[model samples]
Target: MTPEDRFPGPELPETGPRARLALDPLSYGYESGDHGGPQQPWAGPGYGGQGHGSQGHSGQGHGGQGHGGPGGAAEGAVHSGESSTVRGWFEAGGGATASGFDPDAPGRPPFEPTDPPTLDLGAPVSAAPPAGAPDPLPEPADTAPVGPLYAVGDVHGYLGELRAALYEQGLVDADGHWSAARSRLWFLGDFTDRGPDGIGVIDLVMQLAAEAAAAGGYCRALMGNHELLLLGAHRYADEPVQSSAGTASFLAAWRLNGGQQNDMDRLEPHHIRWLSRLPAVALEDGHLLLHSDTTAYLEYGASIDEVNDTVHELLASDDADGWWDCFRRFTRRFAFRGEAGPAAAGELLEAYGGHRVVHGHSPIPYLTGEAPGEDGRPPLRITGPHVYADELAVAMDGGVTMDGRLLVARLPLE
Candidate 1:
């Protein structure tokens, strides 16, 4: 039976291991009498020398002379008289023929074939098989856009404001529970560390995640600098970190960065673990959602997965300095407000494979320089979400922590 017929009517396993080997028969060449083993037949010129096809003579110890026969003596004599001599038997289809001689001392030079075997050194090397099909990336379920993903800007422990914002966006009911059926919700991550009820905010979001997923929608979060700062402060409070500015402690920085004493007091082990596990960015529905707007993420990794993994790994490490740098970078914002803003946003969009970036590190009011209660005047009205970087980025931090409105809106389909 043919090889194909041998496996007829049988199901082959889709995923299994297989072994393979390659054979190259005519890889080298030789002169007349020189012969290679069956496996390596060709022994063209320079087959056993320094350049090209040379596989230096082995076992025939004394340089060029093979030790067993009368031909050995002739080869030794030729080598003795000349500084450089090619001494080897040139075999033909008929029998062994001796070639190459000492041109200086010899009375008559030995018969030299006009066209000796020339090595084809330009033969191509075997290439490795194309990389085994890469493990496929996780593909979005269907072409149909999933849901109207709405991410809440920094709640900063302001539970009342968070509830009001959710209710206003039709995501919650009168009882203050998630009511947006099958609508994806995400907290753009500063769940704690500013106002009262930081833990309450997290509790609400976690409960909402379960509720949303159970109802065929999903609720997730990304790690903000506050999360990392809080984690670092709790885990390495006693550790001192040396920075370019000066020696600073994580606990101190956290407090100065609006970390509330009550929130830190209420922090538990599970909360710390959960915060540390939060990714720095989440790509959802063609949007790259992150907390900060800095290119420092490029230093974390080249790809989205790499950046997330590296950031999480660094947060897990006990190196206070590394964690501090991560926190510092994560807090930087307004990268899209300057001349290089477009290029910076483009870099992030390319790396994360997103059409636009949605972030919460900088509040829209701050970007617009219209913070409320400033200069003893009323706050300017913000009718809608702020789109910056020529509409390539959206800033959602509405400064709710400072009594400004918390933003909750559907991603613009356009």
Candidate 2:
């Protein structure tokens, strides 16, 4: 069954104070070496033991609840209170597997191995309702302004930073998960690549969508070029393709961009299928959400859904060069940075039907001249989530992968 179908709990109420759910801290295990007991493997690619990967999945169960109060605790497991334990699971196998237990399986016992496992107990346990308990519908906060929309820039596998930024924005709790009620969150894409835990980032976002929807809010993500590249590499790695710059291959680009060897090794059929099905653009609350800030979308279709459908159809084709070109064009950034950038921004606004365009493919630091190692220049600080471009575009990418902040903010009604 689909996640929505599997998680058909009561919808959170549309009017009330923000409902808070305390999450118990959870633990996980990792295999060391091929023997799967925390030892480095000395042989061929190690699958480890069946139960050596569980840390991140434990945390994922409570991701939609705001991160606050006492964290949950794991029952009958060794606890390694290291956030890296969660990171390792996402990065370990390139995020191919789901680390957490299935929430839908209420009676499924936790994985128990015969051998001692590398355990990670994240946070303390909380005595909250059981996973299958009927959740009270959360009421919407009338006091808050309407059209409470938010956009996140590229996550790029920096799960810790993304969580911290979400908390800072009051969207999540201290644990780096979502919690706000009756709010809308739009991710501008590029969730993986060039950092640790790209897979982890995607897993978190996917989990949040279920959580947020249950809580009377919504979390939606756009398809970024990196996602396309990752999917392409997994499906068409051995297939060569032509590019604007020259002949290019997704596998080569993925590796050059620090694609984790573990990720490629763990590329699963489901992950590729999900990435392939991602939509290209999303529009909500008078804002346009996309990965890149270019007018090239006109080449696809007129309506937002049409464009997404067209792109999906193209990606499904066997024409490797066409797919690569689409990936390359989407990867381009800084279309709204310079003096002439406003014109390009206007063209997009005219097509996409949003007063403002929110995107993450290009980070805000790169636009404001604060990115590290930019010709020996010092980094610049991002003061807020919204960056106005000729008063038509909002750059949401906070450059979290490069030590910049992650942008998270509610959309203000005009």
Off-target runs (Cα >4 Å) in candidate 1 are 1-145, 372-374
lDDT of candidate 1 over 1-414, digit per residue (tens):
100000000111111111000000011111112112111121122111111112111122123432112211212221121101111111112111112111121121121222212111121122122122312222322343255677777777778878887877777666666566567777788887545677788777776665655545566898887788778767766356765434555654554344444566566776777777888888887888888766667889888889999988887677788887777666655566544566778888998789898888665654554443213556545555677666778777776644456677677523
TM-score of each candidate structure, all chains considered together: 0.63, 0.63
Question: What lDDT, from 0 to 1, does candidate 2 have?
Answer: 0.51
Count: clashes, candidate 1: 14
- lDDT (Cα, tens digit) per residue for candidate 2, span 1-414: 211011111111111221111100111111111122321211110011211112212132223331111222222432122212222322222211112222232221122222211112122212121133213333343453332577777776667778876766667656645566556778878777655567777777876776666555667788887787777767665355654333455654554333444455455666666678888888777787778766667678888978998898988788777787677556545555455566767777788788777776655544554434314555556655545455677766665544456666555423
Best by lDDT: 1
Per-prediction count of colliding residue pairs? Answer: 14, 32
